[model samples]
Structure formats: C-alpha cells, structure tokens
Target: MLTDTVEIDQFIRPAEIEAILDQAAAAPDSAIEAILDKAARFEGLSHLEVANLLKMDDRHLPRLYQVARSIKEAIYGNRIVMFAPLYVSDYCVNRCAYCAYNECHSFKRRQLTQDEVRDEIVEIVSMGHKRIALEAGEDDVNCPIDYILDCLRTIYQTQADLSGEIRRVNVNIAATTVENYSKLKEVGIGTYILFQETYHQPTYERFHLAGPKRDYWYHTTAFDRAMTAGIDDVGAGVLFGLHDPLFEALAMVIHNEHLERTYGVGFHTISVPRIRPAEGVDLSAVYPNIPDDETFKKIVAVLRLAVPYTGIIISTRETAAMRKDLLDCGVTQMSACSAVGVGGYMAEKRRRETGEIDPTLTAQFAKNDERTADEIIAWLMSEGLVPSWCTACYRSGRTGDRFMALAKSGQIKNVCHPNALMTLSEYLEDYASPEVKAVGYALVDRELEKVPKSQHREQARRNVEAIRSGKTRDLYL
Candidate 1:
C-alpha cells in the first residue's frame, strides 16, 4: 500500500471519501431521492452527497440521468459551446506511461514554426471554429513559455477566410509558475486548462515516472498559482481509467470545493477525458479501470449534479452516440471536428482532399468522433440544439465569481441565448456548407424569437441581420 502523502490529505481525505462511498452504497431509495432533490435546486452538493450518487446502482441511474438533464437545462439551456484543439507541438520530456508523447517513445517529435501555426489556425477558422484549445507536450527546451506566447500571438493575429479569426484560445499545457501564468493572462488567453491526469497521488507518481510532472504536489497545486496570478477561469479534470473512477470523481469534487474555499470560485469547466490507446502505451495493461458506456454516462451525470454551475466539457474521445447521450447529462461544452496532433488540421485536410496519409504527421491520440464541424453543427440544429461559438462573457468581463453569480441567478440566459444565435448566424454566412447553412439559418430564425427583448436583444438582432447581409462578422452580444 502507498503511504499517506501530505498533498493527498491537504486536498482530500481518502478514508473520509471511502467511508462516504460505503454509506452511499447502502443508501435507501428515499435517501437517494433526497440527494437528487438537492441537485435539482442547483444549490450544489457536498462531497458525501456526490459520493452517494456515484455509488448508486443501475436501478437508480435513470432517475439520476433525468435530474442531471433538468439541472443542465436550468443552468445552460440548449446552447452547446463548440471548440477545437490546435496542437502546436508534440515535444516532451515526461515519461508518462499512458501517453504517446512519453520521452521513451521512439517516434519523431515535432513543433510547429510560427508559419505552420498560422496555417493551422487558417484551416481551423475555415471550419467555423471561433474557439480553440492550444495543446502541447511538456519540453522546456523545445516548447518554453516564450514559444507558447509567440504561437498565441500568431494565432490571434492570423486572419482566415473572409476576416475570420480565432476569438478565444484556451491553453492546455504543463503547469508552471505563477509568473508564467501571468504572462499567459497578459497575452489574453480564455482559460488555463491543465488536467491532473489522476488525483490519486500514488497513481499520479506511478504514471509520471520521470519529469517535472512526477511531482504530484506541484502538479496538483497549479490551479492555486494560476488563480493567485489573477487568471480567474481555470479548467480541471482527471483522465478516467487511470485509477478507480469513483475515487477520481470524488477527488474532483474535493478539488472544486478547495478552489471555492480558497479562491471564491471553483473550476470554470471540468473536462472528462477517458484514456485511449496511444503509440507507446498498452491501454489494457496500464489502465484496467476503464468504465463501460453506462458507467461513464453515470459519471458525467454525477458531475453535473455535483457542480451544477460549472461548465462540463465532453471531448471527441467519445463516440457520436455517446457524445449525444452525454449532452443531456449536463455537458455544456464540446470539441467538434477536433484534430489532436501537431499540425493535425493541415494533415487531416490534405488526407481528405488527396488519398495520401502523411507519415510524418503523428496524432496525440486517435479520435473516435470523426465528423466534420459542418456536419456536427447541422445535426445539432436538426435536434433543436444551438451550436454556439459565443465568447461574449469572457470578452465582456463576466468571469470568475461574477459569471458564477449571474449563472446561479439564472440571468445569464438573456445574454448567452442572444449571443449564441448571433454567432450561429455569423457561422452560417461565413464558413458553413450550403446544406448546413440552410438548416442553420432556419434554426437561427427560430431561436431569435426565444431571446428576450431588450437593448442587448435589439443589438443582437441588428448584428444578425448585418452578418446575413455580409456587412459584418464575428458579432456577439
């Protein structure tokens, strides 16, 4: 058994979590319903309450899913915020056992030059993505903080077809000092996303055999530093299948609670990424705790109930059917038509146009949802859902506890709904295919009526009309 680590105790008490899990396993139907009632109120749940819901059996899962959907609708409505990943580099010094970028891998490593970064952003913009999560492997020598800032400058400055550009760039890189985070904030990043990989200290130390990432305490405390450095919006998550899923889920709740206690706000978003097969890793041997489809859905639902106000993100790692199912279970954000490798967008476009695969282009992980962005947007519209590209809150100064206060008070919809429609209209006019554009226009027209009439609504209407008439672009409330 691994010895008790101070880091673990400082964040989460394993024995307390375990004891709550045991109690939850034996919770009666009335007790479970009481917990669901609490979730419905959007008041947020305690760690013990979350553990009980996680311990629920399949018999109670249907109710749990229903409550989750209701809570999601109450908070975020039908708008699904869309983004794509832009991997600028694959260089690494870490020897993580479950990643292809592990230092022990024999594959060729590559980092994009400023020109290559511009090209990638162009392709991404042409696909109608206003938001991107810039990803990179850890390597101070190759991908230092300065390189990251330069890439950010390149992305924000490079204009795509018809003056389209990346409006938000959330970064997913290795943890560094508060000074580095402040630098990223100065460059105008949307969110500082860093996955803990796993919250279990022993499991974290085991997977990260060699590198700066091997220090569990340093990695776990990264959010505190970022928040202190004045980056209000931070995203946290764990790679499921690394350890017991229940333990990881409970630990996530503990983490969010800690952030709320210390920083006055928790995670702005919580990403749920399950481990998948990679070049250097044996999926089955290294990650034996992978959850089945039902189990995974339950986890997402529980997370929704546990943190009703925080945004939940579902990535392209899941299948189309699974992603669709999860949307109702409180997933407010999603990555559509994502490419997970360095220079992956260019490579994928080339492969689609010509039937040749680029041997030099390596993917960080294989994608399960391979639909194009247009297809995903069209499908979402057909289902009465709005595929939103809105970044108004971040730009308009509604971040951190301010945003949370509005979200909790149910007033954000007035702003979010109108902005979502305006951005959707802009997408239809600029980047969408004919078929998608037709469906999207109809959806936008119908959704316009739903936006409550006010000064902002009138402005959004004018912006939508301007976009339709080719007078403006990238307009949001």
Candidate 2:
C-alpha cells in the first residue's frame, strides 16, 4: 500500500487563492482582454487567469461564453457522452448538512442485497445505458467496500432481458486507503470519482459534522493515494453552492494543475453539481453560494477555458434549459435517466407500472430534469448532438496520460466520433423506443458522413448494418 506523502496544504492554499482573486478583482479591462486572448490559445489558463475571468464584468461574459463554446467544439466536436447514476446504498455514518442521507434525518435507510442489485442492473441496462456511476454513502457497517465490489461484480455479470450490458462502471464511493483503491483498480473500475463537496476548509468542516469524511486532509488527498494505487483516471469536483462559486472555481483549477504536475494527468472528468433542496435540508436556512443562471454559465465557461482538454460534466441538478445552454459552453458529458436514491430505479419502474409512488424510496437530492433516457437521447439528436455510449478508450488502453495526449493533439475525434456513431447504432437497434429509434438512427446516418476518413466511415456504416442484422455488437474504432 502507498504511504500518504502528499501535503494537502501544498495543493490547496486558501490564503493564496484569496490573494489571487483579490488581485484579479482589481484588474483593468485591458488586463482582462489580454487574459482572454491567452485563453483563446486552448492552452489552459492559470489560477490567476481563471480568477480574472471569474471577476470579469457582466458585459464581457458573452464573449467568454463564445470562446468557451468554440474551444469545446474544437476539442470535442458535437458528441456528448451519456451515462446514468445507480445508487447502491443510502446508509451513511456522516451527518452532512446538505444530504438527505445524513444521520440526523429519519428516513427508511436501505442497502440492496445481491439479488436486488441484479434487479437494478436489469432495469439500468433496459434503459439503453452502457456506462453508470455507482454511488453509495460512507457507511462501513451497512455498505462496506466488500459490498461495493460485490455489486460491481453483479452488475458486470448480469445481462438484461434484451441482451443489454453495462460496459463501464465508474465508482463514486467514500475516500479510503490505497489498499482499497488498489482493490478497486483490480476490479477494472473506470474512473474513481469523489466530489470534494467544497474545497474551502471551513465550509467543508461546517457541513461534515461527523464521520471519517470530516477529516479534510484525508479526503482532499484521496487522488494521491488513488494514483499511487495505479488507478490512472480519477475524477474531481466540488459541490458548487457550498462556497463562493469563484473561489471554488479557482480551487478546481489549482487542484487539476497539482494533479497534472504530480501524476502526469489531471482529472479525467469534472462534475459541476449545484446544491438543491433535499428532504431534510432547507434552502432558506443554509447559505449556499448559488450563482444566478448567468453567473453559473460564466463559471462553466471559465472552467472550460481553464482546462480545455478535460471533460466537464453537468448533471440533472440544472434545469433542461440551463443544461442546454451550458452544453455549448463546455459540458462534454451528462447523466440521463438518473435515480439518486438507493433502489430508486426499480421503485420508479414499479411506480410507472402501478401508478403508485413508493414512499420507502428516498432521493439523495431532487433532480431538475425528469426526462427518461430515451427522451434525453432523442432531445440530443434533435439538437444535432451525438449522444454517445462509447467505452472504447478505457477498454482499449487509451487512458490517463495517453488519452489526454490524443485529446490534446486533436486525434481523439478520429476514433471517438466514429465510435460514438457505432454505440448509438447499438442503442437504437437493441433498446430504443420506436420514436427514439427513428430519431437516433437518422442522426447516426447523418453523423457517419462527417467522419474524416473514408475507411472509418465505411467500416462504421458496415458495423451499424451488422448490429442491425444481429451479426455483431460493441464494434468501435
């Protein structure tokens, strides 16, 4: 097991961050323009530069959004990778103020049995999803690491009624030792995702009233242990509304830079989850640093310019219109048909069938977008976007620094765009509803033409045909 050698203070110096933001807040218009001009090069911005962008005047925000959109297009093109969250357990030992699963709240706590996990997997696969983020709260007794591994094994082994299977399972569990992370890596997990909740130490301490999660240093240094354990791709994020949005944004850049400097690759994905009201948490009582719609857009745009190659994820916490608006600014990945509660998907399915909402099942937080997976996929197609379910890079060994190198050099599209079309073809043929299938297939046909290489284009067309004809599946470049 790897020893803890990383100093959290080195990476997260709150005083330095405050100083930088203070300097940025006083910058003249010419200084802001120079920073923006530098950002246009696609070579990520420094923390100071990011701070300046965050403090720019409202009138200059539109130009910032435009640049972010251009950079996103240049790097990712029109493809948006899609996935869903499968909450395995809601049992927790933490008294976090922001979550409904906090020990203080009186709810029917539950963890899925192996059989129940299999049932959930069937429902998830039926929704035409190839990737899922497995979530659980930090509870050693009720939801141990062994239980998590068992759930991963079950989900990976179980096949749906229609032959649908989960191709990638990204884990979002509590911070643990390097030994546990190594075990997770051995199980072939995709990304080790853990949201810092908030990088501000005071805010973090205030919210995490109890449990191991309250240790700010240990939680902050999780990626170091993960990387040392040979888990190459780690995802990082902060709960946006927990602190000053600008401070959190600057801290995110610093965090990414620290990882890149140490591990040779930064975050594989950055999730932007804004806080929302839950069963126990009252919005009026808590002082969440919720940015206005326009300011929120600017935050996403600045993050895009700060880390051009990294994937920025926007979850269902944002409204459909907000999600749509931010998509062009920087978001390259999103969750669809998500259920934040333990056993929520199966309960939701049962409710749909019987017209009875299950009172026992409780959500972690409320979602703003309530569309089904097929509905979201169809919407993406209508907007001229490719809703991708491709997991080729992880399975093909193009991860960590290797994936970043391909993305930075503009070569990933040659593989990713075609792979997206192939995966969407599979979704349409195997699991889409009639209306969604029609839209998805039409979108695939048009997108396949945009592939740069004629050989790849022809092969993709043939692969789609093979998938449709029941000859093959999971074909990718």
Candidate 2 Cα lDDT to native: 0.89
Every model's TM-score:
0.96, 0.97
* Worst window of 10 by summed lDDT in candidate 2: 1-10
Number of colliding residue pairs in model 2: 0
Displacement of residue 394 (Cα, Å) in model 2 is 0.5
Candidate 1 residue runs with Cα over 4 Å from true position = 1-9
How far off is residue 382 in model 1, in Å?
1.5
Give the poorly placed runs of model 2, Cα more than 4 Å off: 5-9, 161-163
Clashing pairs for model 1 are none
lDDT of 2 by residue, 101-125 (tens): 9988898899999999888888888
Model 2 deviation from native, Cα RMSD in Å: 1.4
lDDT of 1 by residue, 89-197 (tens): 9999999998889998887789999999999999998888989999999999999999999999999999876647998999999988888888999999899999999
